[model samples]
Structure formats: structure tokens, C-alpha cells
Target: QLGIVTATRDDGFVVRTLNPGGSPLYSVSELPLKLARKCLDVFGTASYDEESSIHSLNTGYDDEVSSIYGAREFCLLRTTSGKVLYCGKPSALGLKQGGNAGSRWQELIVAKAPKIAQVAAGHEGLHAVLVGDDGSVYFTGTARRGEDGD
Candidate 1:
């Protein structure tokens, strides 16, 4: 089965996950431009030295965005516009989100270099962790107010 991603402008997204011994599952679509902008608003400003388009913007994350599980991990991200972004890892769990951005919210970048099992979204930012046999929780994206410290 093939997993297909779908996206909407003002509304959320839905994706179709095709798997064996399972029914067709519809989920959110990929990060579309409009949706990307909504996400950016929540983060802060969309910075572009020169390589940037005015319509929509997004970044998976660089060597930044950390998870308690490991360094250079992708946490959940609240783009400037309020769109929710998540990395395809484990299945979506209790994953909860609200209207407030963390006092020190950080960007969520999914690390694709290594295979991921699951990921989740939180207040300040996003949190991601690898799947454990016994099922213990890992940590990521714990932003404080400011550097001087909030």
C-alpha cells in the first residue's frame, strides 16, 4: 500500500496511509505553502537572506531543534501563522496543542537521516522520541521565555 499526503489552505490536512491488513486511513496532507505561512506566524518572522519567496515558507530544521532523546532532533513547530507541522515518525499519540506558543518556543525539525518511529506536538514547540520496546517517553523542544532566561 502507498501512503499519500493531502493538504488544504484554511483547513487542516488529511493523508491516505495504505497498509497491509488495514483499511485506507486518511490523514493530514503535506506542508502546503498557505499552511506553511500559518505555521511561520506562530514561530516568529520568516527570515530570508536572499533565497526566499513571499508567498509561503518553511524549514524542516538544521542541526538545531533538540529532543531529550538526542541532540539535533526535531521538535514540534508552531509556524508564524499557526499551522501545525510534524515529522513522520511513530504514530500520533496523545499529541496535544493549544493557541498559546511556549514562552520560549523552538522550531521542530524532523531528522530523516535516521528512521523515526513517532512524533508529537506540544505547547512551546514540538516533541519527538524513538519507539522503545517497553515504551518509555523521550523529551524534546523545551523552550524558555528568553536567553537572559524566562
Candidate 2:
């Protein structure tokens, strides 16, 4: 387990792009050594700018604005396979990265967790206003203005 990962390639592929970060993303699966090198370039050249990254990653909206305690900013993630998701993070979790609730795009819905329906961002955190089929709202995260939710 030396920990050197490699690519599984195919034929009829070509090198497509190499980012500024030295990460080489390829299209040619036929080329092994070159493909791996290109893939590495694509990964390495990958840049991370805070605001831009966050905006780009915030893709969709399904979660509604809420008065829930932890509800922060959110997104609706429909997988390529066509699964609907209403999700977000609590203020406590939102404040950190790699917490239990992480956004898929912007809204992170953990499997087995309740479906977070709506979200409204607050000054310190966000509010997740959740609703079950019974039409009841469950408030969990922070409210925008110091509990007053002003």
C-alpha cells in the first residue's frame, strides 16, 4: 500500500485540459502514462478561491426558508440518477467544514436524516424551516437575528 493511485483508462480518448494548478484532466483513455500525468495535472491545477468556489458549488434550491435553529444556507441536490433532496446545515455545523452535515452542492442532506425543506440565512448562521407531509414545521438551527429572528 504505497498509496500511489492510478487511473483505469479506455481507448479512443484524448487529453482535453490541463488546469493552471498543474492538474491534467484528460479525455484519451487510450494513453495510460500520459493520461495519468494529465489527470494529475487536472487535480494539482485545481484552484480554491473562497467566494468563487462557494458560489459555484451552490447549485440548486429546494430547501425553503425557515425558523429552524441550525438552518444555514442550503441547496436542493438531485443526483444524476434523479433523486430529490431538500437539505442544509445547522449553524453549529455550518460554521465548520467536514462536519456531519456537509452540503452536496450547497445543501448537505445526510442519509437517514430528516429532509430539510426550507432555509433562510441569518447573520450568525441560518434557519432551517422543515415540513413533513403533515404540514408541520420543525425549527432546529439558529434564527437570523439573535433569537428574535429579526
Candidate 3:
């Protein structure tokens, strides 16, 4: 599918599809001006810089948890207070088993990790790496199984 991803001046993000042979499945002009601005804002200024200070960042998805579910995608966001926010396509976040269907980003009430420097999400959106200011690394989510299946 032909799609165009763009960030708007209003701090929002949009995804539009373009038809191969037609003007577009939907016209750009007809597209909604506000799409996922709130979601995009969750990541605003949420990055961690080890050189500056120890900040926490939430990485999306946990493969270990997703494996139990249906391998749904999720977004993770960390706050200044070390609170991790989660949202996405999954209905439950591993522990709980039902919600608004991941329609909006929500904070993980039980997750709190302070003094975090950086967080990196895995390409599969199943795991994340947390780097502490002291250069310590922490891994979360599912682990890659070895040939022995240990």
C-alpha cells in the first residue's frame, strides 16, 4: 500500500494512503487535520541524554508479554517521575486482560523505574533496553530463545 507519513505544524502525525491508479483512496484535502497529535506528544521531550542527566524513557512493547497474548504492538513512554506509559493495539498489558483496546496511551501504574538514562525498543516491538546513567543496561520483555530452548 502507498502511504505517506507526515508530521504537522500542530505537533501531530498523520498517515495517508495513496491509490496506485487513482488520485488517492482518499484525498489529502479530505484527510483529517488532527490525527494522532496527542499520541505523538507523548514522546515529545521524553528522550534521555546520558551526558546531561538521568532521565527515564518508556520503550514500546514487551515480547515476553506479547508472546502470551497475540503479538500485538504497543507504545511505551516514560515520564520525568520514572513512570512508564503504555498504549497500543493490545487489549491488555500482560497483567490486566481488558481495556479500551489500546485506543489511547495509558500509564503503567505498577511500573516505576527511576534514574534511567535511555530506553531502546526492539525492532519486533517485543522488548526494550534500558540504560542507566551509570552505564548499566537493563533488559525487559521477551528473550530470544537459544537452540537448546533454555
Candidate of highest TM-score: 3
Worst 10 residues of 2 by lDDT: 38-47
Q: Which stretches of candidate 3 lie over 4 Å from their true place?
A: 1-72, 89-101, 109-112, 133-138, 146-150
The candidate, 1 or 2, that scores higher on lDDT is 2
| Poorest lDDT segment (10 consecutive residues) of candidate 1 | 41-50
- For model 1, residues 1-150, the per-residue Cα lDDT tens digits are 566666666555656655555455534334343344333312222221122333322444333222322112232433333222443222222234433321223333333323333444444333333333235444444434441124
Error of 2 at 98 (Å): 5.5
| Every candidate's lDDT | 0.35, 0.36, 0.47
TM-score of 2: 0.27
lDDT of 2 by residue, 22-92 (tens): 34543322323433321101111111212323233333443323232222344333333223343343344
TM-score for each of the candidates: 0.21, 0.27, 0.37
Model 2: residues with Cα > 4 Å off, grouped in runs:
1-103, 106-125, 144-150
RMSD of each: 16.3, 14.1, 14.8
